[model samples]
Target: MIDPFGGIKGKELTNTSGFFVDKEEAIKEVNVSIGILENKNIKKPTFLETLRSKKSKNTEIHNNVWDYVPNTNNEYVNIHIFWSKKVVRSKNGVPIRALKVALVGLKAFYRQINTLKPDLQHPDILECYKLSLENYQNLPPIESFISSEKQDLLLDPFAGVTGVDIYKKYNDLKKDKDLTLEEVKYSINFIDQLELPKSKRDKKFITKKPKFVTFTFPTSESYLNVHLWWAGQIIQTRKNIEIGRTRLALASISKFIENIDVETPDLEIEEIKEMYEITKVKHEPGKLKTSRIELKPISKGGLSYWSTKTHRWITGKYDAKNKIFNPPKQNL
Candidate 1:
């Protein structure tokens, strides 16, 4: 494998100045410094250990490491040192030791990169250090890295709305053309009552369910059909209402549903009945025709492109495609 941080020479690796031309050299210096400290029986401080020292106002021992690493004019170098000291003084997890090690390494790396000859300096050198340090500081708790078999369990006693309910409600509403706004509101409430799944670990905890419940459908057409059906029901409640007025009402209701924390008994009902009429007319049987068309590939440079002519229905047979059937279009 290629070393992303160009490999360093033996002389550069052992250089006591702690400066380096690139990241690889900087990292090597950090590791060597950490090793030297360890060899002298100096134990690296843990996150908790440093936290207790700071709370007690005894951070002198922690500051001793700064005396060994050379300070530099580079902003990233100074910032890394500041963060490293802060991490040692406060922060959590085993990664704090890793951060301290990285800070030691960066001190040498930044020193070299900052002092490099104008032509030798890489544009991304400073950016690489900045991003690396940022990512390191944002590291999550170590336990998050561990895999667990635990899965979320549905807290609700009922199985919640399924595809069966979708079709059943659709068919029932189709037969009963007189759908009241109260009935539509009741259906929305029924769906909202369905609780979201909770983790098994949080079984005992009580939490409020989300305002909306996402119902899954077998197909995209079915999802739209269901929402359109509900839209139609809202439309039915008002007779002789203009399509534009009904559309505005439905839009208002949809917006209102999104913002409310709880359902209101006196919630206003709006219109969408005109949309149902338009959709019903467009989807009428025999209005659309389905036919297969040949799609030939274009040739280039005297080479005939290879493509097989496959038969596919490009339009209209709703029943053949297993889609919802629309009402017959009537002459205006």
Candidate 2:
């Protein structure tokens, strides 16, 4: 059993010196402590009794308060100390004993760490302290930072155009800046009439119900007959692609209904409207395509490279008229 209260006899310490726990020598001190108690002249002491008997108040702590043990380096274990009274200055009002008891606990914990590395000179035991008054990091309107201590507070946010600028820009200002009683009642009616106007698209689509329809992919056509025949199909309102003939023959117009380049030689706005009939979402309202599931082992040739910062798969799409994505010529 280690005595947290290490070797110190109050009578033995000079004004400038107190006993320090020796990691390698702790066993010797432990034996000595046992010897002291068994002596007929000395009392058989409990841990606290030994601490009270050993404490010398004027003892100072200097050094190793922040050391962490590392595998390669020599590690130092700590020393534990116990004390009964705290030393005070010449004109002391409050006894320093209360502070001394706390420091004793702190040093005792450090003694354990100091034992591991005998070469360590300074033990990792920071001096313990208590501030006499609250140190305010931000200047509060209150006179003092002390809690439960009576304070006269006059609080207001700082001011200028920074103050009045808020009033002209926001209806919220009526509540924050000290508005007059009459102004407060009047602002309720004034702000009630203010409205954020509904935008053009909001008015257009907000109430309109979406139309959904499914489409079968068109059959492939022999070289020349494709576009000529496709135009005839939409216009004819009917076509027999197997025979490559239509009841009506109109040019095969491109049917694109997604975002436009705005720079692309786009079809007229009226034509864009007609495409809605074909591209209207199927299965789910506003959903253009049904879900697809894909999972593939990615590789440069045939092996995984875990070094990449990001890993994902890429997919492609097409644009017929510009031949832009029939085979994308450049990265998009």
Candidate 3:
């Protein structure tokens, strides 16, 4: 049998595993396919060509691509190709080969009658749209551009950050004063509005929900230990430290998996606040909203109070000798 892709006998690139599509051949095939489609009886959509050169002249199908044709009533099928490539050593430790390309994704577009002009006409929406269009207009032309790194950054869902918590930190370090949070919000909204469909068979294309964990407060030594474990994981995630609802949950879960001993009694507010200060992470709304933890109890118990001055928890204490609080409890 003859090999379609020529074999390599030299050293391979690092960090690449498996095979990658031959970039030169892939580009040639793409161009040929476009020519064939354009010459069809009914001109095929040029959208595929748009995807080909969007990132670079030699497209490697790093992510995914889809060909959409609306109002076809299933007569026309949308094409989707998710081709991933990696560099890998051969059995002889020579060179890499392209992984078998799989065509798993399919999509079909349908047009819908609109009664939503009113919502789009909002002044704020219009203004954001205007600003976004202006930004795109000001960008350098493709021929004059140095690299596609900036374009790739804009296309990232979380801007390459692990999550919202990390994204916030990443944004703060940006020196570009024109890149406001509002503009970022508007840009995301714009992308979401261009909602694309996916093939049922393409399991990899699906967006899974972010994982979450629960933790009750005034917790046991084990529970406190879990929180501390989470703290450590969050610390190791990056050089900068920032806490958020989701980040804290992930940390606790990591600690639980290791079965680490819980040395702390409880994860008091003061301890968390002190951590924020040490890490220089700003404590704002939703910054440390730990989930699965009760803030106040309905039954008999002293109220949990937070001290603004000390930034610590002042737990409700019972006076066993007096059989009551020193000042006595107030009746509702």
Candidates 2 and 3, the one with greater lDDT: 3
True-vs-predicted CA distance for residue 293, candidate 3, Å: 44
TM-score of each: 0.15, 0.12, 0.18
Clashing pairs in 3: 16-87, 230-251
Cα RMSD of all models vs. native, in order, equals 28.0, 33.2, 23.7
Cα lDDT over the full model 3? 0.26
Question: lDDT of model 3 at residue 206?
Answer: 35
* Highest lDDT against the true fold, candidate: 1
- Judged by lDDT relative to the true structure, which candidate is superior, 1 or 3? 1
lDDT of every predicted structure (CA atoms): 0.30, 0.23, 0.26
Q: Which regions of candidate 2 deviate over 4 angstroms?
A: 1-21, 24-94, 118-332
Going through the candidates in the order shown, the clash numbers are 3, 22, 2
- lDDT by residue (tens digit), candidate 1, 1-332: 78876785465432212222234443444454455545443345567877766353332223322222122221111112222212211111212224444445445434444322211112123223333344454433222322222213312111121111111232222332223334434433333222334332233222422121222443321121123234233332333333223323333344333222111212243323343333344322322235211211122121112211111111222354765433222221
**What local lDDT score does residue 96 receive in model 2, on the 0 to 100 scale?**
25
Q: Highest TM-score: which candidate?
A: 3
